[model samples]
Target: MSDVGDCLFCKIIAGEIPSKKVYEDDSTYAFADIQPKAKVHVLIVPKRHYATVAELAQNDPAELSHIVGVAKSIADDAFHGAYRLVFNTGEDAGQSVFHVHAHVLTGEVLAE
Candidate 1:
């Protein structure tokens, strides 16, 4: 796990930083991405900070699954459950934020 104090997603979850919230629950927070790649792009992050999806999975599989559930719910509301869930594990993979998050992208036909 990474230091939650410096994690951007953690700060958003803590209300230290403002975000366009889409959904929130006891274990997850979903918000609009500042730089969206799709028409409906939301980031679903766990309240507990984990540096990567692998880290989150190793520590708590249920939490990781919960994030997916959140993503599915977001898609269901936005575009009839048609969406893509993505996780960029490393910096090289375009994971700008260190905290693990699922990108919920929908509202259009995404490219393969």
Candidate 2:
């Protein structure tokens, strides 16, 4: 898979950085977000690095689908089949990590 230089998520995927991996496949990786916003917060990413969803959309349709599909599986298996999926595309949207990722959120933490 293609990785970006100095990308945090990329390092996590490559085993250079440790992460609490929840799920992984050839095209995607899922893990707990270090800074979580909900009780069950997981971040799902495409194996190939993309700074934003827009970038990912331009590169591979199947990659995008794989990321979302894995996120769905995470919720279905761990979060009782209910969760919110979020994507922060740019600086204005609070996207700290440049690589594109989908956040899976569930439980009362978000209700507060």
Candidate 3:
């Protein structure tokens, strides 16, 4: 697998940084967010070194879909209810990590 030298998500997926993994496959890796916005917040990251979803979508559309698929399945199984899939494209959009990832957020308010 290719890795960006300073990418935090890469480090996490590489097992150098500790993370609570929710799901993992050849193409994607899902783990709990350290700074969660909701009670159940997980980050689904692509193993490849795409800086943003737009990049992933343009270069590897199938991998992008796989990330979303994993996000859907993990969110459904973990929350057993509705969840939000969020992609922050840039720093202004609240993307602290540059690695391409989708955030799965399930909230009590969503169920209400």
* Pairs with steric clashes in candidate 2: none
- lDDT, candidate 3, 6-107, per-residue tens: 888889999999999989888888899888888889999988889888999999999988887887787678677678889998888877788988999985
Residue-wise lDDT of candidate 1 within 9-95, one digit each (tens)?
889999999999999999989999999999999999999888999999999999999998888888999899999999998989988
- What is the alpha-carbon lDDT of model 1 when measured against the actual structure? 0.91
CA lDDT of every candidate: 0.91, 0.84, 0.85
Q: Name the runs in model 2 displaced over 4 angstroms.
A: 1-3, 107-112
Ranking according to TM-score, highest score first: 1, 3, 2
Which pairs of residues clash in candidate 3, taking residues 3 or more apart in a chain or in different chains? Answer: none
Model 2, 32-103: lDDT tens digits are 999888888999989887889988988897898877778777778776678888999888888989999999
For all the candidates, what are their Cα RMSDs to the real structure? 1.3, 2.8, 2.9
Q: Which pairs of residues clash in candidate 1, taking residues 3 or more apart in a chain or in different chains?
A: none
The candidate scoring highest on TM-score is 1
lDDT of 3: 0.85
Q: What is the lDDT of residue 26 in candidate 3?
A: 87
Stretches of model 3 off by over 4 angstroms after superposition: 1-3
Residue 112, model 2, lDDT? 30
